[model samples]
Target: MSLHCPSPATMPPADLPAPAPHTPIEDLQALITGCLFVALSILMLRESRLLTGGTTGLSFLIHYLSGWRLGLVMFLVNLPFYAFGLAALGKRFTFKTFCAVGTLSLFTELIPGLVHFDRLDPVFAAVMGGLLAGIGILILMRHGASLGGSGVLAIYLQKTRGWRAGSVQMSVDVLILSLGLLVISPGEVGLSILSAAALNLVIGINHRPDRYFGF
Candidate 1:
């Protein structure tokens, strides 16, 4: 007797349907990962006395001026954008974004106790922090959420006008970084621009609509 096994050419075709958007469990995992990375990025920026772009950068500016808690400032700064998010993006998207923002706020506050940095190079911090933040935001975007603030506007414009979210974000970021000249030194502002460029490069390259299929 001879035994027969199916060879690759004889097997069924491997074509498969596109995957459905993330389930709740997967979304939760993404949220956790995104928040942790963002928190770490913020910590690196803080340690290095650097700032990136967007509303988070505004929070940093406020924190520097007022000596308030960065996490709290960031959370409050993001609150006003929820209305726009709800109106333009819908209830589900806005709700998920709210949760993501809250998680990030809490994580930023708690991370200091969990992680410590004895020494960090400013240039290294700027580049790494920007990259991590860009990746974290990408995760949030893929999971149907955002970090709020200008992110809401970016998504809204993308959906309504076909503008790229990353490009929109980069424009806003450059404006915010320009404002940094009032508070931070010109050299620091230059570093912030570099960091923002790195962050936006990630978004521009990877966050395009054609690149990702998930909601």
Candidate 2:
């Protein structure tokens, strides 16, 4: 059965079931599922030569400018953020974030060879990629993990300080996409904004504290 958390203002009845920690199996599947969605979204964005938000977008910029492997760049770029996650979010969260980052990097490397799209429309790719990314991120967050970088900070602020994760992420996303003008075309940047909007909208609307009551 699905577990919907009670509102913060509402007290559970005496016999209400206590929230249980996610099983290792559940976390593993969630990591795989979440990363796969993000991996596919990355492929779509790469095909369209579009930018995304977060360190992923920064990695894309470096990849474009240096002609380096995106997976490697992505993994490296997210490295320092793990330390911050560990300090701010604790061990399990940081460990899962680390694993999530590695798995996403690996998926980004492998998915391209396995899946091919002959003619992916740019607009659809932008929106669909954003939607997939949002869903993926939501899965990771609910499972007590994140993609590192701004994601870690966003979650930290949300949990400790009551800031909206989506808002924090959205602000950073705008700056990163704005910086995209240095590498990508204005038109692509505009589309990237649409993608960011689709992404942040999902988080803004759904990632509330009372939505889930588990770590």
Candidate 3:
């Protein structure tokens, strides 16, 4: 995401904003697929004894420390962020994000009962998990939705203050992943960094504001 969005009124006649809203069916499908991908990424990270960043990473940290269900914790951890999302991103985005977060929680809880991995490679898990999470987030962002927390803030900054969403996201990830060290080993933290890099790389290269027009 880039920082220099020209408002329709201020833009030249040839550069006016032209955002085509998503259809209900398209949004529903995207919400489902995006949440499912993030859920699967969480599963991979959990099984491989790793964590990434953002609210998901925070949820993992709490889950590791509290022996709580990751899905439930994730849902709860995202609660307060809804207020900021509603204020900054608008009602439609907030509503979609609420549903997306809830769906992700449900999927994370249910997927384990349906799938299992006896031996997951850590390196593969880190890369694939990051990629999956990145793709999921990209889908949501394109549809005027986010996973809440820093995702919302990232988008808001891009839309209003002209900050790069990818850069803002990575900065937050660095902080959250640093805290992961308290709960995980140094090596696991390194993998977590790799995952964040892969995840943000997708966002940095593909989700630029110059390319993204949906609102």
Candidate 4:
């Protein structure tokens, strides 16, 4: 008896296989992650008198300058990105992201009044805020959902050209943070940068590829 491997001629066509479908549990996890992302974002923003990076950060910047509701600004800023995400990512990802964004917007508007963090010390605020936001972002990532800022572009570039998501995110984050120079004082800019670093730090340490695949 001889052991033989199938030749290329006998191999199954790649196109004939269907993509694996996500289960209900996966969807529930995504929704829970989205809720956490929103809650943490609002908590961070309110606690630190600071902003998150990416489009949510931009929304805060706009709110600071214009007195508009932060949630409204977030929703508006993210609108254009939805189409971009749909094209670059996929329907499931895009839909989850959209839901995440909406939930975040609603929470941003509702959480401030419901939960107060007015007395948190600035240093503690920054550190805790970053930690919470980092964990929340990690959840979104695990579920194939994004908050729709630099994240969208990061995934797009990663897929198209085999770029690392972290590098792309860092580049976009740097650019977005630079905008703070024009809107916020230099000292606040420094704090924002620190908070941003903390967010990435958690992501870097806790979300290693080997450990991130499961819930």
Each candidate's lDDT (Cα)?
0.77, 0.81, 0.80, 0.68
Candidate 1 local distance difference test against the native: 0.77
Point out the worst 10-residue segment of candidate 4 by lDDT: 1-10
Which has the greatest TM-score? Answer: 2
Backbone clashes in model 4, listed as residue pairs: none
Model 4, 193: alpha-carbon shift in Å?
1.2
| True lDDT of residue 194, candidate 3 | 90
Backbone clashes, each candidate: 0, 0, 1, 0
Model 2 TM-score? 0.85
Residues 48-101 of candidate 4: C-alpha lDDT, one tens digit per residue: 666667787778779888999888888898888777677677787788778877
Model 1: residue 185 alpha-carbon error in angstroms: 1.5
Off by more than 4 A, model 3 = 1-19, 153-171, 212-215
Collision count of model 4? 0
Stretches > 4 Å off in candidate 1: 1-16, 154-168
Question: Model 3 over residues 1-215: C-alpha lDDT tens digits?
Answer: 11111223322245675555679999999999988888898999999879878888889999999999999999999898787677666797789889988999999999999889988999999999989988888887777677887766776777789898768877877788899889999999999889878887877677665554554
lDDT of 1 by residue, 1-215 (tens): 00011112322234746556588999999999988988999998888777777789988889888999999998999998888788677898789888988999999899988988888887888888888888888788777777888867776777789998667876877788888888888888887777776776777677555444444
- Report the C-alpha lDDT of model 2 over 97-207, residue by residue, as the tens digit: 889899999999999999999999999999999888988888887787778877777766777899986688768777888889999999999988888777767765676
Clashing pairs in 1: none
User: Which parts of model 4 are misplaced by more than 4 Å?
Assistant: 1-26, 158-165
